[model samples]
Structures are given as structure tokens and as C-alpha cells.
Target chain A: MKWCTKDIILFNKEKEFVDTVVVPLVPISWDKNMTATVREGEHITILAREIEHQLMGRMVEAPPFTYLKSESMEERMKRLKLWEKNIKESGIGYIFYLTSDVDWNQKNHNMLDMIWLPAVPLEHMEGKARDAYLDETVQDILKVITESWQQFSE
Target chain B: MSNKEHDVTRRQFLNYTLTGVGGFMAAGMLMPMVRFAVDPLLQNKKTGKMVSVVSVDELTDQPQRKTFKVKKVDGWHEFEEQKIAYVFKKKNGDIMALSPICTHLGCTVNWNDPAYPNEYHCPCHGGRYTKTGINIPGTPPPAPLHVYDMKVKDGTVYLGDAHPRGGA
Candidate 1:
């Protein structure tokens, strides 16, 4: 389910059935890596949307967790842990943290399932190339997610 | 050599005019969308509106996902929302369209995923359905996927509401 009013109402009633959440962790860098930051954010947003589309009814996509590029890892994680705590408290058991930022993975890390992938530029492609890339990537992500579901249930 | 036959006499002109106008009026009355055209001043019943999604010839044995928009009236608000249906040609040479929403939890199901080839696979809870929309036993879906009310007009496939086969 999407993070929208209509889906929220459905999510409220059907929260028992939907136990998973996909959170796109996006980084913002204004002074440097501006273009790259935007590109990664765009890809993460689209990828998260496609993932939510494929996994709708079982998972609700939370709003992206955005933070500054220069922010300390401790500060960023402190903020993320709050989101994780609230989400888990709200009855969502599984949280898949989708990110193109490698920094999140390298960090000592919070409890969020940080799914880090190298930020690949999707801006140059069009038509079938873009869709093919997205499809292949989403398939791989879904595999990892389903595998996680198997183990995470316990 | 046939100038006399090509020429329209007064009687023939009146006969053609009446037939053409009468036929047009009759058609406007009988069609679903035209009930109001026939009698807008009387009571208006909500008719099942069918939207043209694709041509019948374009459908193949492999199911193709198609999206179409419908004007939905919700209380005082009337708005349009896009809907998706998987359309395919059956073995018996009939066009079939099924709703993609999984019956178990409303997630979109894909046709012929690598994990579940030749069947609709719902990645959410691993729901599986046969090619004909019947849910596989032991899967999460309790009933078969809903089938769209369809019509073929001038080789175009027009789909109405998807009616669920209530039996599990």
C-alpha cells in the first residue's frame, strides 16, 4: 500500500494482514554530489514505487527517510531508529530499508534492514532499456525480500 | 446507361430520409450509453459502462495486462480511475479478461513469473492461480480471480465490471 490517504484508511482496517514496510532511505547533498544525490533519490523513489506495486496489500511503503550527506552517521541513525521504533510499534514487523547510498550499509547500522545497492544512473536510458533494467533489478530485490520474509518470520 | 436508376425520385428521397432518421433514433434508444439520449427527462438508471481496452485481434494466448479508465460515481463525487485487467485468448478461441488483483489481499499478480511459470504469481504471500484465473489449492487466495464482463464490438474488446466467481 502507498503512503496516501486512501491507502491509509485501507491500511488501518487491514493492518493485520499487512505487516511489512518498505522505507527508501534517501540522501541529500547540496554542496557536492548534487546531481548524483538527486539521481539516486529518483531511482530509489521509482524502485520503491515498483516494489510497493508488486508487493501491495502485504507491505506499505513509508515515506523516504531523507538526511543530509554531511550529517554524522550517529545523528542519522538516531533519527532512523525513531522511525523504526514507531513503525514496529504500529504493528509492522518487517521493514525493508531500500537505499542506493552505500554509506547506510557501511554504518554499524540500526535494526532497519538496510538494502544498499550501488547507485546506477537510469537517466541515460529510455523505453525498453529503462523498463528492462528496472524489471531485472526489482526481480532481484523481490528475491532477497521473499528470502528475508522466510527467515524474518521467526 | 443507368442514369434513371441513379436519379432519386421525390418518393424515394422521402423513403430514404425516414429510414435513415428512424434507424438513428432507434439505435440511440437501444444502446446502453444512449438510454439518456432516448429519454433524459425520465428516470435514469445506472447502466454498466464498458470501456474499450484493446482490439480482439490483438489478444493472444499469452495474457496481456491492459489499463483503462472508468468514470466512477462515489456519492456526490464523480471521478475517473484507471483499472487493470489481464486479457488473453483462450484455447477455445474466446477472449477472456481477468482482474489482476489477488483475491487474498488485493495485491497485483503477474502472469508467468519465473518462480511460478505459466501461472499468475502474487509475490506478496506467494499466491498462485492457474492460467484461467482459478486459485491453486493451498494458496492464500480463497476464490478464483474475478472475470471482467466483456463485449466485442467491431473487433474491439470492451470490458465492463469484473464479477467475482463467489465460490472458492
Candidate 2:
């Protein structure tokens, strides 16, 4: 369910059923060349929202963790691990890290499954084309999550 | 001369009293008219309104997912909302329309997913329900799927607002 009040109340009672938590990693670059990074952040947010919408009952979307682009890799990883530990302790068995940051490698992460998507500029496109692109991306993300779930169950 | 100036003219007093009473009578007469003008705006607009979805002849025992657009008014805004319902004909000549949303967490449930054949399966949390939308106990859903208010008119089926069932 969503993080909204109405859904959170229901999610609280049915927390056992929700085994997955999706945390969106948004990167913020304060430098002058922040346009591309900002665009990537927006894209990842939309992707994460669509994934949560597709798998609402099984997944709860945690508030996105915004990190500075200049932050060290070690520090970011440490923060992510702490977040993962807290989420796991709350009864979520699966944790998904969704981001458009190509620097993140899923193989390096032990506790969370990372879905890395390349940054594609969507500001130029609108209406049907943008919707179709987003839909395809959402399907791909769902497939990845479903495969992970299958592997986990097996 | 000062006392005479203080005394009011009889015709002026009569005119003042008549105008005050006339204004009251006019306001009383206009009150209902003003209410009537804005009555619809003040009333609740979300009352269940039936909208036709499909024809009776096309319905089979197997549930068919039908999407229909219904005009919904929320406060000042009015728009058409696309609603989906699983419509099927029962063995006893009864028509049933079930909402596709799972009661567990409001996820859309599909009929006969790969893992659970012949039952409505929610892809989100593996919640399953019977053909009649009754939630299978021990599953994630706490209650049964909602049933839409259904009506048939001239061989066509129409659905109204859906209500959640109390129990399985």
C-alpha cells in the first residue's frame, strides 16, 4: 500500500502480508550542472511510484532517501544498510532499491535487491509516447521483482 | 418649537412602518427561491447511479471483465471514471457482478493467475478468492471482495456503487 494515511492504517493491520519494501534512491547534485541529475531523480521517482502501484498489496514504498551526489560510496552504502536492517526488523523480508544511478552495482549489495535503470530524458516527450515508455519500464521492473520473488521462494 | 420638531409626521411614520414590514415579507418570499436555485449544489452528488455495462445475452458462466465509464461528481468537479467489474451468469439464473479489487490492500485481482487456476488471484500478495468473490480464509485479505449493485433493463446489465461484504 501507499504511504498515505488511509493506506497506512490498513497496512499496519495487514503488515504480515506485506513482505516487500521499495526504497527509492534519489541523488541530488548541488553543483551548477544539476539538470541531468535532477532529471534522473525525477525519472526514478516516477518509476518507483509505478512499481509500487503495480505491487501495492505486497509492497510498501518507504520514503525516498535523497543523497548528495558528492557523498562517498562507503557512506551511502552504510546508510542504505542501516535502512535495510530497520526495514527487515519491521517484518519485511524483501527490500528493493530502485534508482537511476548507474554507479550503484547490485552485485555489491548483500541485503537489498537493486533495480538500476539508465537515465532517459523524458522532459522532451509528452502524452502517449511518454506513457508508453513509462508503461514498458514499469513492466520490466515488475518482471525483475517477480523473478526475484520466485527465486526467494524457491 | 423644539418639541414640535421632535414629533414625527403621521404620513412619514406610516411609510417607514410599511416599508419595514414590506421588506420582511419580500425577504421571506425570496428565501425558498434562493434555496431552490442552489439546492442541487448543496445536496450530496455521490449517490449511487446505475450505468449500463453490457448485454445479458453475452454473459456466460465464466466471468468476463467488463470496463465501463460512469459519470462521477465529487463536489464541484464532474468527470467520467472508468470502472471494471467481473460479470458472470450463475447456474441458478442469477447475474453477479464482482469488483476486481482485492480486499487485502486494494490491489487489482485477476481471474485464474498461473499459480492459482480457476480462482481470482491477486498478483500483489497472493490473495485468492472464490468465483463468488468470497475471500479464502488464511489468506491476506481480511474480508470478501465487494459486489456492485446490479440491475438488468431491456436485456442490458447496469451496475451501481460497490459495497464491501461483511464476511466470507
Best by DockQ: 1
Candidate 1, after superposition: displacement of residue B127 in Å? 3.2
Question: Cα RMSDs of all predictions?
Answer: 11.8, 5.9
lDDT of 1 by residue, A3-44 (tens): 999999999988778989999988899866899988888889
Q: Model 2 over residues A97-123: C-alpha lDDT tens digits? A: 888887686347665588889888998
lDDT of 1 at B154: 96
Candidate 2 wrong stretches, greater than 4 Å: A105-107, B1-98, B131-144, B147-168
Instruction: Output the number of the lDDT-best candidate.
Output: 1
The deviation in Å at residue A135 for candidate 1 is 1.9
Interface RMSD of each: 1.7, 1.7
Chain B TM-score for all candidates, comma-separated: 0.72, 0.77
lDDT of 1 at A142: 82
Summarize candidate 2's per-residue lDDT along B1-168 as a digit string, tens digits: 468878888899999999999999999999999999999999875658899889999999989988776787788999765567999998898999999888877777878767788799887767899998888988888888899999999999999999987746
Residue A99 local lDDT, model 1: 93
